[model samples]
Target: MTTASSTSSESSQERYQHALMNTFGAPKLILTRGQGARVWDEDGKEYVDLLGGIAVNALGHGHPALVKAVAEQLSTLGHISNFFASGPQIQLAEKLISLLQPASGVGSRPAKVFFTNSGTEANEAAFKLTRRTGRTHLVAMKSSFHGRTMGALALTSKEAYRAPFEPLPGDVTFVEYGDAAALAAAVTDETAAIVVEPLQGEAGVVVPPADFLAKARAIADEHGALLWLDEVQTGMGRTGAWFAHTASGATPDIVTLAKGLGGGFPIGACIGLGDAADLLQRGNHGSTFAGNPPACAAALAVIATIETEGLLERATMVGEKLRDGLAADPRVTAVTGEGLLIGVVTTVDTAKIAAAALAQGFIVNNATPDRIRLAPPLVLTDEDVAAFLAAWPTILDAAEALA
Candidate 1:
């Protein structure tokens, strides 16, 4: 085992470049520890984490509830195979189904969940479930990202990600996102499923027209195709709702979730409602560690914490302030999204803006060349938002100058 003293002199960047694959290019920072919405680097430099682990840290880093749940569950039972059921796993599933109720908040549909270990894996499970529909064709939206796994990759519309990984699962079609007419035209009777993100997170938090999701639901119904919403990035109270589609008034047959579900722990779920629930047979899919006690406990704690802390209302309130503050600067052309998942449209290079923000002791993401995305922790305080707002103009100025 390598001790801290053994590698203290070497730079993490140099060590990362030497030991790890270059898939993500270079290391940004070697973080040592985190608490609430703030993290410290190896050098003890603290930065407000505006990205929130790409919207995964729902309750922020090292929340006591999440930590305690994971610890206690692991101490009790860590890994029981799927052959036997566990309390946390069952409870988490029931909780997720309950949260999938329609906007009316009346009653929820009967839904069954298949757990996985990440957002991509959840999408992969949903993809396989669609194939079990006996229709091979799938309709996806352009400028959409599902995951890197082969099945999920086939459903993703970006050519850059698909170019090298040719021979992806076949019969996948890409349609213009937010264009209901195009979606309707593309989805046919032969289509097994129409997979979409409630709001395109990687495509710079792009939200569709209010009626677009409803239209998709109608089109899918017409074609006998399942409507699958990828809520991996937009669900679990990130959008100030349990799920983003609830606000759109679209009741989907299937929903894939991850990211904030387990807070910081890795867990995902492919939830199928109504008849869609029975598509996958017993042996069709299984995971060794998908619904393990620790992950499920962590997720339950996150949900409990959100309820007790009133983070959903807080997310909406803070998000409004953030969006308004970001748009106050002339450099920001537009801002979109709900809750903590905000997108800042800029005329200048967003990559430079990200760098400027980092230099100023903040961490955010450049989702695209012109779009800066902020998916801060749900627990982010008013003071944190104020700090970012205070530095927004200066950060933009430095970025604009660099551009």
Candidate 2:
């Protein structure tokens, strides 16, 4: 049985390599099943998934609520064109608008939402919406990552991702991240918008200064540029809050979301608040299958599950435990980020560390050469954290020796 399974897995991998585009490079494991924070490979080896599909699986795999919601929605009405609306779509849009409300107790500001299939698409939609401002100039931060699509890629600071696809959308300025002065200097009256991630996730869960978002809000207000916060990774209770920028009391004009929003389902949202809400008028934007019923239902289920399961508070508690435990290791130089969105800087090569972690039945991401990022499921249990902590030293030792 084992030999047959191995042969089948290998055959399938070869078929995949031959058939699919080489964009992702290679497959790490042939995942067969998952429940909660654990997953099983084709060989039936169980591993703790600390990366959560790059922070996508908030409720984790095979979550009954998510599965049921999607199933029921599909059975009732799977999809409809953007010209028509569904109950799930309207409900999700309203839910997201309520969630995007700032926590500062300010008067309610009306917001509108545009749904998309993924984070990059959400960013692309927002990018086009910015152009509706009649100003082409935009400002983004260095080392920041918004998405990979051409429009989103234009705002991303990494040259490697941009170089191959250059002559990207122009009229964008990249300024040093976390540098308020640089941001202020870059944003001018002609700038349409300023895009930033409340916490940089792909650049290894980098958190900005406490006042960074506030300063950005002030700067955008001063320059008449829309303040766009990309919360695809840090929003939807991932950071123990509805949104990361809310913690800084910064109310952004535009917000993009995805990743964990659907608890693994493909759904993204671009929100516009206040006067910005009306910028993208009719005929300005459209998506064929953006707010299909099943996807919207799945997202609503994830949000409901998060609220009912009290995962937000749990994320904070477990995150502190993991952060403190990981930092205790002398080899771990620093720990950053809040809640489950964590990044660990190591003295050893992160690739080796990731390999060692896999050997120890753990799933983590080497987000950068020196940073190991962990965006585990919000429902991560105390037992899982304890097990990872117990094995941390051994993983490091093996990685160090391998390095």
Candidate 3:
């Protein structure tokens, strides 16, 4: 019978290990509350949240707009079955389609959306939609991470994640990421879809060559296969644009979205454009809680806030400052990604760097042994950025010492 007022980090950790599954390992900080880009732990230690819940908190924690929207929606009409419809749900679907419209000033394609509770579910729906083409083969990129669900796991390329679950949904080919030649070779007329992430977030914010996505689009068109872009971590202004693939000028047939779409309220979408829009017939798929009113309302608020606050431009400006400052350090070898989704390749072990950052009241992620990722909220202030940059050298120094 633990009460919130009496709980501490130590007690929470002990209780967590006993009650919860070990999928995520031990908790990092046992955070209690957050606002803007900062959070506090059970013990009241403050930290600047640079990870932004792994790029899901687009408007930051406890944003007034998001809070009000979710609360009001839940009070009015909360969870509803797929058999019924809600205004927020319809509006959100239309809004997502509008956001995906091309920025080239050309006419937009016809698109349809299927909402889900998470990115993996969106991908799973897309996987089923691809199967509707009568071709079973899918071409995916190496180092890609779709999700942990069975269907999405089959599409993901990491062997370690797929080893235990052998005999996955078959006919997926993996190619070296960013290699247009390999992509061309892998996709054939029998291919149902060619799926890729605009920016490989789990692979430390890896960005393909500027022409790579366009090449994939052309290749998919050549074979008459659907081109799918998994923008789970890169959409909703995470990379300064509504969607990261927009910069490549490639219009994908199927686009899966999540992570930031609900501003931490758990919503995902699978969008099919043009002829692919009607692939999922009425009886093809369904989810009970997907696109519930509260989630949709929260997502709408996030989008509205992003537009009204000029957070897209802010993401770009703040991201440039962080990248430039991080790259100036001698310990850092490279800085990649656009906008707030950034990766820093450093000379020291990234795990140590992450630990050092935590000790210094900043939260970052060790995306790989050598790469540290930063996906701070679009609302991150100049003061927070300045604080992190001022502590950058010392964080690196501590990491180097540990190494």
Candidate 4:
């Protein structure tokens, strides 16, 4: 059996296909290294990264702050089991609680945090917390993406992702997103929680009505159901705010965060506010590597850097430029989203646009057949934006020709 290292003669794509599972399909590029918003392939070709690791690279690749914090924390103290908590873990938890203060508005009610290794795990923790309400029914928005885990999948609204794994846990009701009336119709007193993504990311960065979240809050309150906001993709300054729902001023009982929380490191959090905070008592849930020191330190560093560098304002500024430039093109039908999480609806198939982007030394995501989503690193420079904008017309032209 030839190991990957021993088969140096084979192309990186060939090696990847032989070694990895077929879950994500074929490898698009064999990336070797990255700096800021740019990445280099194994063959040394460079491309501007517009997708930002699917909105995970908040500070961009190889950020000094993230690197330093992880290294220092690992050298000082690494993984510690849940039996004993570390400073970084405790501090990160505190930090998250503080950030959610404005969005929670629980008054004297305290918030509690449960750490996880990924967004799905965080959502899983939140799901279990909802079960503690003594109700098995849940209401989730249509086209909403929470995660891929069994429990999280039960909350997700995509049929393609949930069909093969039928009989998912819980009795979940799906309602039309952005439709407050539909949501009200679905959620009942028996419903334990109403899970929604303030801005639907996987559904091509769909932005609901301005008052949708506030309406969801009222509806949940009317039925005595907890309001769970899944901010896995839009949280942690991805939308120019600590959480995307902050602007809506809708207080939530539960908030799940990940993606940019750890910059590029793997870390997530499940926060329960007010009465929901006490739902998951001891022994209800546990994880082996949920709050490791290195990951927590990385998260802390990411948050600190965001505040110090003013990336929230930067995300808004850069996002505006990208949206305005893209919308100016006749090929683009509409542009939606906030800050760096942008969606471009094209007149042609986005698959062609994505292929054309890659060929033209840019990385973008064809989130759907007709929509292209851009969640670039908040650190994407003016030069990088200019370069992409300069080549935008040609990329569209190539895509149009293919169409």
Question: Which candidate wins on lDDT?
Answer: 3
Candidate 2 vs. true structure, TM-score:
0.98
- Write the residue-wise lDDT of candidate 1 on 102-150 in tens digits: 5414265678999999999999999999988899999999999999999
- What TM-score number comes out for model 3? 0.97
> Which candidate tops TM-score?
2
lDDT of 4 by residue, 72-160 (tens): 99899998888998999989998999888965565556899999999999999999999999998999988889989999999888899
- By lDDT rank, best first, the candidates go 3, 4, 2, 1
In angstroms, the error of model 3 at 309 is 0.2
CA lDDT, candidate 3, residue 384: 99
Instruction: Report the number of clashing residue pairs per model.
Output: 0, 0, 0, 0
Off by over 4 Å in 1: 1-10, 103-108
lDDT of each: 0.92, 0.92, 0.93, 0.93
Candidate 2: tens digits of C-alpha lDDT, residues 186-210: 9999999989999999999999999
TM-score for each prediction? 0.97, 0.98, 0.97, 0.97
- Against the correct fold, how does model 1 do in TM-score? 0.97
lDDT of 3 by residue, 1-403 (tens): 8756447666899899999999999999788899999999887889999999999998889999999999999899989898899999999999988888764122577999999999999999999999999999999999999999999999899899999998899699999999999999999999999999999999999999999999998999999999999999999998899999888889889999999999999999999998889999989999989999999999999999999999999999999999999999998999999999999998889999999999999999999998999999999999999999999999989988884
The C-alpha local distance difference test score for the whole of candidate 2 amounts to: 0.92
* Candidate 4 CA-lDDT value: 0.93
Task: Pick the winner on lDDT between candidates 1 and 4.
Answer: 4
C-alpha RMSD by candidate, in order? 2.7, 1.3, 2.3, 2.8
